[model samples]
Target: MRVLAFLDGTLGDPSQPYVRVDNTGVLRGDGIFETVLVVDGKPRELGPHLDRLAKSAAMLDLPEPDLELWEQAAQQVIDNWEGSSEIAVKLVATRGSEGDPDAEPFGYALGMEIDEKVKRARTEGIGVVTLDRGFGPDVAERAPWLLLGAKTLSYAVNLAALREAGRRGADDVIFTATDGSVLEGPTSTVLVAKGRTLYTPPPTVGILPGTTQRSVFRAAEAAGWTVKMEPVPGGELAMADGVFLASSVRKVTRVHTLDGVALADSTAVHAELCEAYEAQYA
Candidate 1:
């Protein structure tokens, strides 16, 4: 792994310990993050990822992100990374130490090789289980403090959901609202296809707006696929022509089964979308 840290406009060595033990980001998970894909040493969709990071930071009342500084850090890490065809460049910002409320936010960028498991899942597809997120679709609108749309570091619940899916013998999880509306995966966005029309839950459903999914939708649209943003019921996956989970690191992965029930074959559609997605990076 290659890393660069930005501490008050100063770049620090990533391998060295910079974060204090009292940082609230570690203690309370009061932080935000974005994982970007870097191909051939260029970070893909960097502007959008930075924009989303700013939004997440704003939600947490953390210091405004200096995009220029982050860009420098990311570039440093990417330039130093070697021996990998692709890398995952992660940008993270945390609320500073607990005792010093006026301290600047801690921020860093890390570059590492993409996980083999994620690559394998993209190549061979995966099985998923539906899990309740314990919140309704309208919760984000009703309660803003839960930070439903922010990509904060408080991910224990999401990790727990994934573990539960593993225990059920599935590769991933699709979170549903208490009312049974499809939300998204723990680390990915959900998309279902019916013929040429592709459907994904709207951000109003309290799921993070997926940068990779947005890119895939743009590519899918150019390829003559109709894209729709609406509420998807948990039962709709079984009836759809195909289903997929999309994210930056995982790219586009086909869902072979949902809750042990086989979904419609998505081989052709998956191939087309994957081609379109990779074309953007090229």
Candidate 2:
């Protein structure tokens, strides 16, 4: 995937050499970001993404982003980018270059790229495993610092977890609490099918509130399927009728296997949810 980035108000050409590096976001990973799906040149679930970004900024005590400026820049990027069928737009606001770790500034970047694999995963569910790494509930509650629920740029652990999951013959990994309750996936939200209801861990349970999951729940309700937000034990995850991961980029992906345990054929409900979601967005 070739990515195009807008640095401040300047557009850097792909053929150009030597892009300036800013230490604020590059060295310390001191920033918050939001990734939205760009379908037909329009962002999907933009409001939710922005809301989450604001929440994260507040958690970090970063300067609040001017939503009006962000919206304008996002629309400008979408207008300039070509082939918008299945594209990802990432909006990032960071503290500009500075030498002090305690200082903050107002600077941001806009990035756009086209990814087809994420779309494919939605149609065909992904294989996942349970990773033994994640912030414990107590630690997260006490000194979150920057890891609890904020989508900060410090994603080294997330990348490591994904690598470990791949080594275990899985496409993704879901983190479990110290007590073995399901938390969430590396970059997605975990949703399971229990009887005729769809269940996902609540935001209070330490998982990012997935915009796609929220939309799926609404669609499920319209389709006559009950949706509930509650805590799910990791052991009982295997007993679910079906398992799926939700994200803005991947949309909704059913999980055919969780830690080598194959879930039942959920193609029917999966299709129903996908269809409803697409229709609603369309």
Candidate 3:
């Protein structure tokens, strides 16, 4: 991953030692983050991403980040990179361990170039498996420290779930509730299309409210289709016309096979959704 790190208004290589001291984000994973897609040199769904980042920070009790400063940092990096049509920018706000130790916050922005092959997964599709149920529906709803809806730096478990899925010959994992209800994928939102209606697990159901999914829904409506959000059963995905994992990097990719069962290749829905988002974002 080619990376550009911003420290105190200066952009430099991430290999440099310019990270501010006493960053709780590195020390204790005490930070909130948002990943956004930049296409044709403009960030997509910027308003919603910032809103969600603010909410996540509030949920974690972190200080408010300077949104304009972060936006300038992103613009600096975006303007410098030439010929790169698309990339993913990660904005993070860390509770700086400076001054009063309980006062203002510090944070940084990181931008990386994502491979075209990865984004092309929208057309090629992916495979998914179910991880061992560690964060179930009931537990996530009741656990006060669960950070169920926050996109924080505590991503060890998310990476682990993806690793376990790969070990099982899958590209990702769809976490299931203890009672067998569907939750979400490791780093993406699950979208299953049944006819013209697109369904996704609701945010109340232990899933991150995805920005890409929001844009896709808007574009879907523009294309004359209805969208539904409710409890999604894991089994229901297999019976749908098509299944997709939506994220900033992956965009929208079909889940062609689930747990070794080959899903019928419904690339047309994939094409429609991809075109919808691309026309709007890319």
Best by TM-score: 1
In model 3, the runs with Cα more than 4 Å from the true position are 1-8, 20-22, 98-104, 138-141
lDDT of each: 0.89, 0.77, 0.80
Clash totals for all candidate models = 0, 0, 0
Pairs with steric clashes in candidate 3: none
TM-scores for every candidate against the unseen true structure = 0.96, 0.90, 0.92
Q: Is candidate 2 or candidate 3 better by lDDT?
A: 3
Candidate 2 lDDT over residue span 66-89, tens digit each: 776676666766766765576677
> How large is the C-alpha RMSD of every model relative to the true structure?
1.4, 2.4, 2.2
lDDT of 3 at 260: 87
Could you tell me the lDDT of residue 211 within candidate 2? 88
lDDT of 2: 0.77
Candidate 1's C-alpha runs over 4 A off are: 7-15
Query: Tens-digit lDDT track for model 3 on 56-174?
Result: 88889886666777787777767777546776888878777644556457666677787675766666788888665556666657875788888988888889988898789888888
Clashes of 1: 0
The 10-residue segment of model 3 with minimum total lDDT is: 98-107
TM-score of 3: 0.92
Q: Could you tell me which residue pairs clash in candidate 2? A: none
